[model samples]
Target: MSRLDVTTSVPVFTRPLRSTCRGVPASEAPPLSSAASLVGQQVGHFRLLRELGRGSLGVVLLAEHALIQKRVAIQVLHAHVTQDPARVARFLQAARTLTLIQDAHIVSLYDLGMRDGRPFLIMEYLEGQSLAAFAKGPLAPALVVDLLTQVCDALGAAHAHGIAHGSLNPTSIFLVPDAKGRQHVKLLDFGIAGLLPPSEGAADSPVAADLFAVGVLGALLVTGRLPSRGHAAEEPLHGHAWEVPPLPSDLRSALSRVLLKAMARRPVDRYASAAGLRDALHASVALDGGAAPPESLGLERLPGWYALRGPPGVAPASR
Candidate 1:
């Protein structure tokens, strides 16, 4: 393994590394830690400023373009993980997948390149936190519909391109403010979960799995927690024996039905596509008066919505 020379402020990569195994080239071997050590180093044209966060697959860094000076988020694959050819291929495939899908609700991929034999992705830098932060408690029904509709649109666009997000957890669902200070949804880590080795008895297909996750997200938004997993005494309308959490008393029956269908144990019973799920959500909300318009749901009026934007005088970065 090649170690990064950290004697100075910026770490520099050392050359002439040993081969991982017989016949494997030195360049193909995994390098040293690529996260904190590379803070002041240059990856492609971007200069890493600080570490944003770390995940199972890679480290996300806050970086700035050398020439243009534009701020961006860079996801650098852990050098150790590159030992597996399959994982490396999947990581590159994820970058290609992001480049193929373009939607306002999906995080934009600015560039992709190799740094010291490791793959890195340059993406739009978001100033807001993930949906998980704000979803600690039940959100307003109107707000939920508004936010999720954007998510559905993003997923629908990906599905059209023959790509499934496969991963739709709250952490991957980010919430940023638009120019007008309205909450906006930006789905992150598209096609990432598929990059991992498949688990036993996973969903039959990626599309089905994505829809199931959407249902789980819906339940979380409505109840501020995941639905309990257990056999219900009575079978659900979809003929599945699973427990469904009771919605708030104020919620209308139409929305309740929508939740049930989206969360059906059998994929055949769930919404056929993300668009279908989105339409059902809109229709359900419409039946009970109408959902509030986007402009009306400004983040300024909502508590904790501006938490990620920093203190009062700070303006959010442009997307």
Candidate 2:
């Protein structure tokens, strides 16, 4: 048998940082499309709670460490997907890579191993809302800066480790409220994390893949817009898509210039690094704040920083 080599400009190192995640199905596969029954089962040392979400790689269930009582999000692979030896190897590789990453903003992986012929991961259970779950609307520029600043920290950490979150969608960015009642942003998902030495990448480079997406994410979150990243040499997006809605004209202009540059088609044209992008955000916030970002999210002025209306679908969970 032959192995399928990952054909990319960058090459990822396959090594284990912790217990690798491996999966393989038994003679017969269980029914999928429906949640696997483990709502009351014990996985490793964690007790399964309920299903929170699902993705191409696995289903994420909210769980709690039996002894520590710490909350966690568990990702369990589908039995069928794990049947192939190569897929099992890839899943293990991904788990190892994710474990090596120690980013506060990135969802933390507490543990990972095989169970019930499926691979599973015990991760930091975050109380936050995905950028996907929210409707982009008016937000205080300063608040935007704060959230993006946190994202920059996580991205910077990942970049330092040579990991580029292969898929950085709006849902990847989660906003959880802190004890102080302020929103804290967390970057999630590393299933397709490109932690490799690549020869070529999205738009001709590796580092730029996530940077481009981050810019688009910024635009989408700040304004209800889509594909902030520009089109090909043929046509460009100018006041098209959902961006045509009514917004403070100046606010529109500011995001336009900033996000446009970040989403430049060429990697060289985008922010050099996540840190650079963060700096750009800082500068933009300063400029936009010709007036201060409202005291908080669209709320009337308050005496101090506020507990802003979170992105939709994220009502603060009582602690």
Candidate 3:
């Protein structure tokens, strides 16, 4: 995940400590009026709720729009990082880059602005559990395959826009709840890294960032946990963990190979693009086996093949 250029830590949020609205006398008319007196309360017109998570540069929060009453998730930059203009620009870039993508699976970016001198990226307040929650219990192998394919669709769409979802781990994939509460994967968070560069040039072609992350997420789906920070996930890869989430049985071997290739000691050894690994997954090809993106399954448009993606065990619409 760190190799993806995504910061290797949790999300951190900060607000101005000097604002008069903060550190004010407490009176309980509503959490809002009383909370406004606290540091990092209402950012702009959005009412801050609570912290979601934190990382190297800033924290993410669950907030609501004052007038619209719409729910939103916000990523706020830390005052410390704001001191360095480069980080500030990068913070803004995350939003600008997101505006270029229009995919349903990827978290949708709504607005971009500064609050208390710190910048923020406002996004849809998705309601669901993280893939982290999914992995906590058993994940059917078939469901894993379905989810990965959908992610391929998500990544495929982003790459088409010249964006790389730098971090593609379980923490970044949320299971958006349907009316029935069934699990539907909605990829989230494009904050810490960009898979592609802002311009259409060689400077942004480092796709190993996404390929590596997909491999990591796939590895976790099958293994149900992440490798320790700074630790290479060798034991389970070589064979040790008792629980293994089911994916295509042969998928394990292919995942191992693609992971090694994507995480090559040298980036050059990785697949040229994430689409390449996804192609192999579709064929259910084993390690050492090769496959191409099916001509019918063109990346030019969202794959219509999902209709063939019936329930877990059924055959796709066409061969």
Best candidate per lDDT, number?
1
Model 2 has an lDDT value of 0.52
The runs of at least 3 residues in candidate 2 whose Cα sits more than 4 Å from the true structure, single-residue gaps closed, are: 1-34, 193-201, 226-248, 252-255, 290-308, 311-319
Give the TM-score (vs. native) of candidate 2: 0.69
Number of the top candidate by TM-score? 1
- 1-319 in candidate 1: lDDT tens per residue? 0011111121111111122111223343234265767788766556779977665667777777678786666667777767777767776776666666657777545655665667766565646645555454666667777877888888888788777776566556666666766677767666566455553345446776677667656665677553222222111112222234567666667877787787777778888888888888899887977866777653433432221221121011111
My TM-score estimates for the predictions, one after another, are 0.76, 0.69, 0.60
- What's the true lDDT of residue 169 in model 3? 51
Score candidate 1 by lDDT: 0.59
CA lDDT of every candidate: 0.59, 0.52, 0.48
Prediction-by-prediction clash tally: 0, 10, 15
Give the per-residue lDDT digits (tens) of candidate 3, residues 1-319. 1111122122211122122122212231123222224235666666777666555555666676678676556665556767767756765775666566666666555565664556666555544444554344333344455567677667776777666665455555655434433455566655545322232212324355566556556656555454423223212121122123334444446555554454444546666665676675664533435432322221122222111121111000110
Instruction: List CA RMSD, all candidates.
Output: 10.6, 10.5, 11.7
lDDT per residue as tens, model 2, 165-220: 65565545666655444665666555443321222333434457666666655565
Candidate 3's C-alpha lDDT? 0.48
lDDT of 2 at 65: 63
